[model samples]
Target: MTITTTLEPVTGPFVWRGDELSRTDDWIFRLGPDQVAELEEVGRRFIADDPDLRTVSAAQYPLTAAAEAIRRFGADMDSGRGFVLIRGLRMEEYDDTLAAAIFYLIGLHLGEPIRQNELGDLIDHIVGVSDKAYEEGGLPSRTRDKLPYHSDSSDAVALMCLRPPASGGLSSLVSGATVFNELLARRPDLAPLLLEPWHYDWRRQDPDAPADTYTSPIVSWTQGCFSMYAGADMIESAHRYPGVPPLTGPQREALALIEEITYSDGVALDMDFQPGDIQWLLNYAALHSRTEFVNGADFAHTRHLLRLWLRRDVGRPLVENFGKHVVVDRSSTRTEDAVRDTQGHFRIREAAAVRTDWGD
Candidate 1:
């Protein structure tokens, strides 16, 4: 199936200033006070119902209620901006265990409720985070980090902020579909290259997977819906292989064009996250980015957030070679560590190595 970009002119450009994006009357989803209270109550019960669910790890929680919430609300949720951020749903005073539980519950509510093992499988294929550290690393922390716009290994990705940065670390987003549409309208010749398969470095992969790379297209069409996976770093790495040809001038130009649109006012959105606020987005439909941030003076006061990748029940089909951990059939699963190692090649040499004091 050929995926086409559906570029429609933006009614208005998204403006970002500090931690807040401009408010729109056309939000895809907004939680009322009643809904927020209900969600909190559900979170409290979720912890109480499963004593074994709390831990520092993202994978430790039982996600029954949270999954049910996604199953109930995901389809009704808006896809444009292709995201939602629910502010003011406090759970900060709770212990790490309770906080983790709350994060999992919120994820379950907004996403398809798959087992932690399933989440691990996707992480192994995408972010390469192992199952053991999933819970701890799932939360946000203030640090000089640069994550480009790329899709997670799931239909949707969600993050619940427990704290905001003392400075910097703003979240940015752009719609891949919107970019494609614009390119199609202005540069039709370049569209085909985006739909063709490209290689990715799998930089987060464990050493045992062979010093090779994985391949997939930036744009894919399955079940009549469009999906994308575009990251310039990964795309450039593919050229190192003997058989792979370099990206054509037009292809490179197309990528640059998309990046320009993404960074511009027409398609991008930026916001500072606050405690108790949860942001959920369609992974394939949008590109997400984060700015580097500084840490507070104390460890306990550092910025932190919890994240999850979810497979929506009603979403499009997986293209071949797209989901490496699970069969395209979606019938099997494994622990994230078993499928692949989560540790990156880079390691901190000392305690201060983890500090975010350097310039971006």
Candidate 2:
């Protein structure tokens, strides 16, 4: 039975920001000597094993802090704020190898690592790798550009800061729930557009990869919970494909409102990064962005970050047929024929709860 539905608004711990979350330090977990030592040891072991980046499994790199922090972090992602910052990583003490091992282990505790793309890379480098031409459809992470509020394509997205640029890389986060609530109050007319399956360009999602375009809802409601797959940059690029319908004027306005609220006042919680810090954001309930940054001349001084896009073996059920890693349904995947001429016949992955490394 085919059914078309709108996202039904729901409540959760994620529907908060500003005053509702005033203390920045509350979300921070500063590492003490014991935890730092634990990480350093893990890093040493990771390099000693000489495992390829792709082969580094969390099981081999364990953590003393894992049992408690990872447990709480999982719950927080599932039911709390949908985001957290792990502070006090001693990046200055270890080389890149050890530092990444720390990040990898923590991610493993949270969920299984998914390849960011067909290249099968487990870690993505988030730096201004190159200048993007106007036609390149630059991604904010790959360039020194500002990002509009958008959710990542994974169930959970994480970034570990290795270095910071000279200035202007502040991160901004807004609650998808708050954005939804404000829409209902201010622009109820345009809110439903999010529920409809929209075209999302993959592969060429950035300069690093090339692929095809697929369709999924920007906002999906399933099991009485709201899940979002929003990326203003990607959404805008989807229009370039002839297969996707051009966004309506009202849709543009709705996007504008989310961006407006994201920067407008106290709606988004902004934070700066310190070396060794990990920022984890739940792609489902939180929208995130960063300001443009400038790098200094020294290569060592340039900003370097390691990124991970995690998928739990089990997690929230999605209304749209979202797959394990890519945002599109694996089954209802759009083919070249479907994308160009045939519109709605794409297959969506059969709906089911994802079972993460952590038991459901």
How do all models score by TM-score?
Answer: 0.69, 0.83
104-206: candidate 2 lDDT, tens digit per residue:
7788778766655443445666776557732455555567777777777688889888888888888888888888878767878888887777666664564
Candidate 1, superposed: residue stretches over 4 Å from native: 1-38, 48-73, 76-81, 110-143, 205-211, 241-244, 317-319, 322-360
Reference-based lDDT, each prediction: 0.52, 0.67
Which of the numbered candidates is closest to the native, going by highest TM-score? 2
Backbone clash count for every predicted candidate, in the order shown: 15, 10
Top lDDT prediction, candidate number: 2
For model 1, where is the 10-residue window of minimal lDDT?
A: 344-353
Model 2 segments more than 4 A misplaced: 1-9, 52-56, 133-136, 207-210, 323-360
